[model samples]
Target: MSPHHEPPLTRLAWIGMAGLALVLVAMSPVAGQVAANVAVPEPDGYRMENYRAPTPASLRGAQVVDTAQAHRLWNDKAAVFVDVMPRDVKPPNLPAGTIWRDKKREDVPGSVWLPNVGYGVLNAEMDSYFRRGLAGITEGRKDAPLVFYCKTDCWMSWNAAKRAMEYGYANITWYPGGSDGWAEAGLPLEVAKPVE
Candidate 1:
């Protein structure tokens, strides 16, 4: 065979090796990190869908805390932890006099549970509720340290933290690990009730 006339099998083997190289590069840790960023890109506004999906690692204008930091804040009474988990509403279309049961939620020992206030958009009532709840907890002091959380990998906490910042709160902490992490760390939790 001439110098330029390679065997067909040799050509096929070269193509396969190139393909494998591309696949390995795509599967690298750096590629995985890039993919994760693309999958969970931060939104200009609140997250409107898939509230339970993986969330961004950071929130602008807020500090993201882990389980241990959250516990320290709780112990020092340095922050008022807010649980933004949504409460299940009784179906209005159910038969009249139907008994509806509500699920019980447990959160950090002293965290305030503010149900239904973490959605992307809030009605006047919920907006007012969230505003008033924050004011009540912080005693109208916008600079009071406030920690917000829901569940692990949940965006509700992120939305709530951002909302608090929008409301002119000066000190805000986002506890991404949330109650799940707290429980996993062997911390105590208490039955929670939404702020009225």
Candidate 2:
């Protein structure tokens, strides 16, 4: 007899479940009643951002990858796997009794966690920092293969991949299947260090 180890459901299964949930919601009697019967709340100006990985033709020039591609790069030691997740930022002027909770970072195996390199805003200081950090990792080789990732639906990896391309890294890959995707694929992860 063998123990049953359940990895995250396959992507298709997850998508199917999500679609079913939506259908169920739309069919609910009270919720699906006519618009005039329900009181709508005022809009809060909050909108969700699309974080899904772009299609091949929509990814600009960066190569989008799945778990298989991530594995191939990692196993071959053919690329520098960089985790571009940003550290949590705490706002100033918090209430005196406030306590900020921190989330632990468990990045993909063999990844160099480099925070701040993937900020959406492109600036001189950040650019310099990323360039210097990348130079140290790639030994100043502009053509070094670089794989960037963080978490699923995370824009950090996308931003980092673009930055790497701008810096002349000839081999660049955007692992849209980030840490969560890696886990869902039944791959192991490790506690990430704060610095590279």
Candidate 3:
């Protein structure tokens, strides 16, 4: 037998070691939660800031308005209608005084065209542009209600709404029922001519 001797660990030492291990394990979950919560926007798309997760309750009666309501809002020009539709869909069908992105010429009537395309599609640049685009639509007016939509179950509008909230926009609404919803209503479609 070797004559080497070792000091026995005291109870405090065992407790200290156990506490450190517990802390590390506990912290792992928090770190993961933070990473998951900070969901980065898609590539070449708009990134979100100060984002908060949306629950069904918060969106309750929060103007997840239908096609008719959207039309009424459009006629009154009471809200800035944003279309984040991907390229390839037919141009937006805007009612009188309604604004939307012109798929043909990269513009929308009284609305800004921010197509779901290009570099950093969801990066800071796109996010910044969305902020400015929304600003222009509202003309620096916060009270102006903002409505957003895309294709049915499309995530772009949803993302846009979340980002808008992050930007401290109030009275913001998302029409999950998008172009499909509008078409279902048999609303007259206004097609914009292609740009030369």
Each candidate's TM vs. the true structure? 0.80, 0.66, 0.52
lDDT of 3 by residue, 142-181 (tens): 6668887765545666667666765777788777666667
lDDT for model 3, please.
Answer: 0.59
How should the candidates be ordered by TM-score, best one leading?
1, 2, 3
> How far is 115's C-alpha from truth in model 3 (Å)?
1.8
Enumerate residue pairs that collide in model 3.
44-120, 44-121, 44-122, 45-120, 45-121, 45-122, 46-121, 46-122, 47-122, 102-107
Clashing pairs in 1: none
Best by TM-score: 1
Q: Where is the poorest 10-residue window by lDDT in model 3? A: 49-58
Evaluation by TM-score, superior candidate among 1 and 3: 1
Overall lDDT per candidate, in order of appearance: 0.92, 0.74, 0.59
- Model 1 regions more than 4 Å off: 1-39
What is candidate 2's TM-score against the reference?
Answer: 0.66
